[model samples]
Target chain A: MLRVDVEKQLGEFSLHATFSSEGRVTGLFGASGAGKSSLINMIAGLLRPDRGTIVIDGETVDDTASGIHVPTWRRRIGYVFQDARLFPHLNVAQNLDYGRRMNRLAPDAAQRARVVELLDIGALLDRRPGKLSGGERQRVALGRALLSKPRLLLLDEPLGALDEARKLEILPYLVRLRDEANVPMVYVSHDAAELRQLATQIVMLRQGRVTSFGGVKVLT
Target chain B: MLDISPAEWTAILLSLRVAIIATLVATPFGIALAWLLARRDFWGKSVLDAVVHLPLVLPPVVTGYLLLLTFGRRGLVGGFLADHLGIVFAFRWTGAALACGVMSFPLLVRPMRLSIEAIDRRLEQAAETLGAAPFKVFFTVTLPLALPGVLAGMVLGFAKAIGEFGATITFVSNIPGETQTISSAIYSLIQTPDGDAAAGRLVIVSIVLALGALIAAEWFAHRATQRLHGN
Candidate 1:
């Protein structure tokens, strides 16, 4: 479960939003500069709101009134950016293990093998990120995030940079993740069709305000 | 055949030792300072930056004089160190190394700061999202990505330290078998009527040593860049 009610002012733009979702896959649908990424960032504890609070899994990660703010690393949330910022110096296997190591968790061979198999990245483990294609890079990024064992996953336009063929190649894996991974996800995208195909619930935004919130029908 | 006298050999050896010590001693501090300058915004940041680069613009003699005032035997820091720690810098080879280190510090810091600045902040943000604390993100992501720059900075510092003559001569003076480096030895030989042959040999040695360091720096930087970019 995730709840967010926040207000932020960025230079000439202002963002005021309130939304709550218990859905496994909640989609944030908005056009460019519509504050979709900003909202997700706030939820991930990457950005602080001037007012209101954000609760993830019943923990108040951010509460302006009480002055409670959890740092991003302590928030236990996984974020995948549109660019898939993989560590270029590390090979795929090391990158995959990074989150787990950083969190000081005991190496879970079973979990590691499971994530690699699920993402089908077993073959690319020895390869570096620069050698991988865009779609492959995103898969590695997804695997890297998932291995962290996050309470909630925030993906800001995960497939926005890919071509149609690459999107087609990765969508099924995303669907499989939603069905099998069991981690709650907040998916952000501007494309309504993609949201319709994956989002269990939809939150619509227009110029940094949530105009509508409901099932896939709200995307219409 | 190369006919190198024992005195020339001693100067060559002492120069190598001083340059190596200076570069090694300053590298960690240089990286720390460079990282701060590149990634942080605070009050007096510009002032700190200027201070760090002061050695670059100031005349070497002036810089050496300032160092002598602060670190000489009768000076404040030098007196304290001598009284408590029993470490003295005045007219010693250690003082010469200190002078070289100060002269080369700006060269060590500039490339590192630039490389650190060139890194994508998003990558660090991604590391944070993966549950890495700030320190961990720096070590695991930021430091590794900035390695080529660090290498370039060290090489620059080493080269500067090896070539450092003005500040070193001013601070430690040219004493044979103690503080006389290749540059000082060459200067002394030039003053002697029959010492032209010795000075020429020392000059050749200096060029070879400097060229070797530059070539090694370039090779290491190229390899590091390739590895970082996944080439």
Candidate 2:
């Protein structure tokens, strides 16, 4: 379960949002500058909310009134940015192993193999991210996040940087992730079609406000 | 004409020792300062920046005199250190190294600061989301990515240290084996009546060392640029 009721002031724009979802994949649908990213960042503990609380999986990650704010790393959440920000100095295998190392998790070869197989990134493991195509980089980023064993995965337009062909290539992998990964996710995107295909519940935003909340029907 | 004497060899060897020691000792402090300057904005930041660069612009003799006051045997910091730790810098080779390190610090830190600034902060955020704490993010991501530039900085610092003359001579005085580096040795030789040939040889050695350092710094800087491109 993920819950958020937060107010933030960012210069000329102020975001006031409240929503709770237990859905496997809660989609935040909005256009650019619709505050979807800000909302997701708040959940990830990257942005502190001026007022209100955020609860993830029954744990109070952020509560402004109580002055409880869990840092991003301690929150045990995964984030995939739009640009697929891979560490340039590390090879794909090292990048994938980074989260496990940082979290002090025992190396699970079975889980590693499973994620590699699921993402079809085994062959690319030895290559640096600089060598990967856009689609391949995104796949590697997904594998990197999944191997971390995060409670909640926040993806901000993972396909936003891809071309049409690359998007088609990666969408099926995302669908498989939704069906099999077993991690609850907050998927943010502007395309209604994308949300309709993946999101079990939809929260629509416009200009920093939640305009609608419901099933995928609200996306239309 | 190319013959080198034993006393000249001592000066050459001493110069290398002073420069190598200075560069190694100053590196950690340089990296820390560079990261602070690159990633943070605090009160007195500009003042700190200016202080770090002071040695670069201040007259070398003035810097040396300040070092004398702070690190001399009877001076404030030096007196305390001498009484407590039995470490002394006044009129010693160690004092020469200290002077070289201070003079080379700005050169050492510039490349490091630029490299840290060039890193994509978003990558650090990504590391944080993946469970790396702040320090881990620095070691694993920021430091490694900035390594080439760090090397460049170190090489530049080493070059500057090897050639440091004014501050070193002033701080430690030109004691023959204790504090006389290549530059001070050359200065001494140039003033002597029969010292032209030896001075010429030392000058050539200094030229070679400086050129090598410059080339290495250039190569590392090139690598730094490429590293940022993710290649």
Candidate 3:
């Protein structure tokens, strides 16, 4: 379960978003500059809201009234940016293990193996992020995020940087992560194709406000 | 008798020592300052950034004097350090390092800050969503992406330290066996009769060292960039 009631003012464009979701994938659909990213950023704890309450899985992550704002690290959320931002120095395997190691995940090799095979990045593990193609990099990023075992996965247009073919290639992995990982997700995108193929819920935004929100059926 | 002249070898060894020490001392500070300037938005950040770069613009002698006033025996911080910790810095090799580190700090911070700022911060945000803590995101996503710049900064700083003359001479004074780095040795030799031969040798060494630093920085930054571009 994810609930966000955030109000932030960036210059004159005020973002006041309030929504809740418990779906496999919740799409924050909007046009460009519609505050979808900002909304998602608030959920990720990257941007603090002026007044709001964000509760995830019955945990009060943020309640500005109570002055309780959990830091991003403690949020246990995984975010995929529009651009696949992988560590350049670290190879694919290391990048995937970064959060897990930092968070001190248990010494469960079985779980690690599952993530590697799930993303099908076993072959590319030894290669550096700087050496991979766009599709390959995004896949590795997805794998990295999944390895951390995040309770909430925030993908802010993760496919935005890829070409058409790369997007097509990587979209399935995202969908699989949505279905198989069983982790709830908040997805931000303007593309309808991804919404149809992935989103189980939809929350539409315009000018930084939640304009409409309903089932994936509304996407049609 | 040692095969190498005491003056020549001592200067060589001291130069290397001072440069290494300066690099070690400044690198971590440089990276931290760069990251702060790049990522965090706080009050007086620009002022802090300007202060970090002030050594580059200020005359090295002025910087040395400032250091002296702050770290000198009778100086504010210096008096405390000496009385409390019994540590002495004036006219010592450590003082030379202080001078060198100050002179080279800007060269280290600039490249690093620029590279860090150039990183798409959204990616770091992404890492956060991936359950990476702030520190983890920095160590994993941000630091690796900013690495090429960090290496460039280190090289630039080392090269700058090797050539540091004004601040070092003013802060430490060119002692024969202790604080006499190559540039100071060259200055000392130039002031003496028949010392042109030694001065010329030290000059050549300085040129070689500085050139090597530059060449290495360029080569590494280029290669790292290529790798970053996935080529």
Candidate 4:
């Protein structure tokens, strides 16, 4: 479960959002500059909210009134950006293991094997991010994030940078993630059709405010 | 066949030692300072930046004199160090290395800072979300990516240290076998009537060493870029 009620003022744009979702996949549907990314960033503990609280999996990660703010690394959240920001210097396997190692979790061969097989990235283990195609990089990025064992996953325009053909190729993998990964996800995208296929819940935003928050039918 | 006098040989060995020591000593500090200047925002950031680059603009002799005031035997830091740590820098080869290190610090920092700044912040943020602490992120991601710049800085520092004359001569004096590096040795030889051949040979050696370091730096930087970019 993820709950958030926050307000932030960035230049002329002010973001005031309040929503909570227990669904497996919560889609943040908004156009460009609709504060979707900022909202998700706040939820990830990457950005602080001016006023309000954010609770993730029953733990209060951010509460402005009580001055409780957890650092991003301690929040146990995974974030995938639009650019699929995988570590270029590290190969696919090393990149996937980075989060686990950083968190000081002992090597789990079973978990590692499961993630690699789930993403069908077994062949890419030896390859660097630069050598991978657009769809492959995102899949690797998704695998990397998943291996961290995050409580909440934030996907900010994960498919925004892909072409239609590439999107079509990766959509099924995303559906697998939503149905089987067990981790709750907050998916941010401007594409309604993509959300319609994957999201169980939709939070619609317009100019930094949540105009609607409910089932995926709200996206219609 | 090339013939070199014993004194010129000593000078060559001494120059190499001083330059190598100077570069090695300055590298860690240079990287730390460059990271601070590139990624941090502080109240006296500009002042610190200026201070780091002060040796570049100041007369080498003046810089040496300031070092002398602070690091000489009777000076504050020098006295404390000599009395407590028994580490003397006045009129010693180590003093020459120190002078060279100070003179080349700016050269070691500029390229490093630029490279560190050129890194995408998004990568760091992603690392953070992946549960890497700030320090871990730096070592795992930032340092490897900034390696090319660090190598360039080391080369620049090494070249500067080798060619250093004014600051070293002023701070440690041109003592034969102790502080007289290749440059000072060449200067001494040029003053004698029959020392032209020795000075010429030393000059050629200096040029070769500097050129070698430059080529190595470029090659290493290219290799690092290729490895990082996976090309």
Kindly report the TM-score of the first chain in candidate 2.
0.99
> TM for chain B in all models?
0.96, 0.98, 0.94, 0.97
Q: Write the per-residue lDDT of candidate 1 for residues A1-220, one digit (tens) a residue.
A: 9999999998988999999999999999999999999999999888999999999999999999999999999999988889999999999999999989999999999988988999899999999999999999999999999999999999999999999999999998899899989999999999998999899999999998999999999987
- TM-score of candidate 2 versus the correct structure, residues matched by position: 0.99
- Find the 10 residues in a row with the least total lDDT in model 2 chain B: B222-231
The positional error of residue B85 in candidate 4, measured at the CA in angstroms, is: 1.2
Q: Residue-wise lDDT of candidate 2 within B136-222, one digit each (tens)?
A: 999999999999999999999999999999999999999999999999999999999999999999999999999999999999999
Best by lDDT: 2
What's the distance in Å from true for residue B14, model 2?
Answer: 0.6
- Per-residue alpha-carbon lDDT of candidate 2 for residues A51-115, written as tens digits (9 for 90 to 100): 99999999999999999999999999999889999999989999999999999999999999988
* Predicted complexes: DockQ each: 0.82, 0.84, 0.53, 0.78
- Per-residue accuracy of model 4 over B1-231 as CA lDDT, tens digit each: 559888888999999999999999999999999999999999999999999999999999999999899999998999999999999999999999999999999999988898889788899999999999999989999999899889999998999999999999999999999999999999999999998988889989999999998898788678667756754
Model 3 DockQ (Cα-based) = 0.53
Docking class for candidate 2: high
Among all candidates shown, the one with the greatest DockQ: 2
| Model 1 lDDT tens row, B1-231 | 769999999999999899999999999999999999999999999999999999999999999998888899988999899899999898888998999999999999988898888888989999999999999999999998989889889988988898899898888889998889999999999999999999999999989888987887778678667866775
Q: Which prediction has the highest TM-score against the true structure? A: 2
Q: What is the DockQ of candidate 2?
A: 0.84
In order, the Cα lDDT scores of the candidates are: 0.92, 0.95, 0.85, 0.93
Clashes in model 4: which pairs? none
Residue pairs with colliding backbones in model 1 are none
